[model samples]
Target: MRWSALLNPGFLVAFVVLTVSAIGMSAAIRAYGLHLQKLEIHAPGNRQLSALPRETPSWKQIGTDQIMDEDTVKTLGTENYVSRVYIQKNPPAGQEPIALEFHAAYYTGGIDTVPHVPERCMVGGGWLQTKGAQTLALEDVDTSTWIVDAAASGGARGEVYSVRTLPAPYSDAPGTRVRLPFGVAPDKPIHMRISAFGDPKTGKTLYSGYFFIANGGTAASAEQVRTLAFNLTSDYAYYLKVQFSSAGVSSAQELAELSSSLLGELIAEIMRCVPDWTLVESGEYPPDNPRRRTGASN
Candidate 1:
């Protein structure tokens, strides 16, 4: 009776279906798993991902970019990042000098995991998520003349490294470090993500703006980044987050829109430190490629 039941046509058909389903599932897992693919960590010639430009014709960097301890770095999951404030020089009367708080972080390789965006961190840190994250479509930034990188100079291992290695009036051909530097051009439109937080204690509102560049595309939120960073098609993956913080701004979107010119210029310096996605998509610039191209990252 047991053998006859096992050999029944319905039972045999069900067993075959289960067997085929399992085999197909295994094949799909093998093909699409992120762990099965190669991982890459990219940086500028200076080897410090935080070595961005310090000065431009309009603004100058001031204040220390927090000196992170071991625990902080570990919590961040990657040492390659920047968090600095650039104070605008000599503002017009009745207007406060603009303080552009800038930040960038890159994650790849074994450090691969969920990205940490400010919306979550700030709210958890005692700020209210006054407004949900919003996407601000910005005018295109031209880079035909900018992004000409000289060989990387400094090799600082931590956050103590200054944004600039030389004196003012930034030289395109300085004998010193030239990590990331660029000017504004309106051609390549980019998207920015922004969220606002209110500090109950101070009764003040602060805004955090950012965008994610993963693989060869860009996203406005952590949820979107997850999809872009782990898509089945890409063999290598990384997420470069460029963020800005501002206080006294009415809204995060306004802050981003009002500061578009400044942010556009700042992005030029920031992109130099980011990996050129064109080559990454082409499998030309792997982590070990050694040939650095500060190519288009819009």
Candidate 2:
């Protein structure tokens, strides 16, 4: 008696409504999945590695000539659409290791990993601040005042300042921050000495300096610089220091090249010691003097 009654017009209407609702929900879910896929891997594009001219310093006199058999470095992208940079140092050195800090961009897909944030990774009070995509400003947390020599010779003599601007980590944040961890806590202020000198005429040296920046009181500093110097060697590494006032490392495209001199000396030493070791993407290296285990990563 109920079979025919169950097949009423009302039942058909309810069935059609439920079916449509299910189809709509499925479509919405598929659309969201596609959106997330888009964020997972950014489109492959021109991810320039070194913005400035590069010099391949010789490590012949250094012991690296004997210990290192294969010396090569390649970077790639990893993590939430970010590049994870790594160096595979093989053959190995005994006590003295060779290291070099090869400059790179974070989002470049060619590398397996890159620094979490090249501009924000503070080492010795260095971080990058940005007003927008074009204005990549350097903020100094180091106590040392560094001078800037804008004019650099070589192919980079005319290169202008370029930056990859990023937004704040959180939507509600006040401003964006770039971090390159040098393990200097907010409690202690990092100290450094800085000076710049470059002769575009001879093209021997573009710039040079030593400086320091320490944390004021927090685990981090409010003022940071958009700069970093990575030690090429695995041991006793010192990063090139810069100040917030040291804006426009160059009026031309000489940021990487001009700063290369400062970094070149430091990196050359590392490579001399550890020929097999490649540059790390973490952008973190041990202080020339070894730190305690717990404090190493700091």
The 0-to-1 C-alpha lDDT of every candidate, in the order given, reads 0.63, 0.26
Taking the tens digit of each residue's C-alpha lDDT, what string does model 1 give over 1-298? Answer: 5888998999999999999999998898765532446467574463455566667656778977766799988988778888788877876789988787877788875434878888777987999988877888665332333332323222321111112322344534333422331121233345788888889999898988877777645677888887877765555667888787889578766576645656545554555566655455434566554333423211
User: Which candidate ranks first by TM-score, i.e. highest?
Assistant: 1
Return the lDDT, model 2, position 211. 33
Quote the lDDT for 240 in model 1: 81
lDDT of 2 at 67: 18
Runs of candidate 2 with Cα error greater than 4 angstroms are 1-22, 28-101, 105-115, 123-252, 256-298
lDDT of 2: 0.26
Off by over 4 Å in 1: 1-38, 44-46, 110-112, 140-188, 287-298
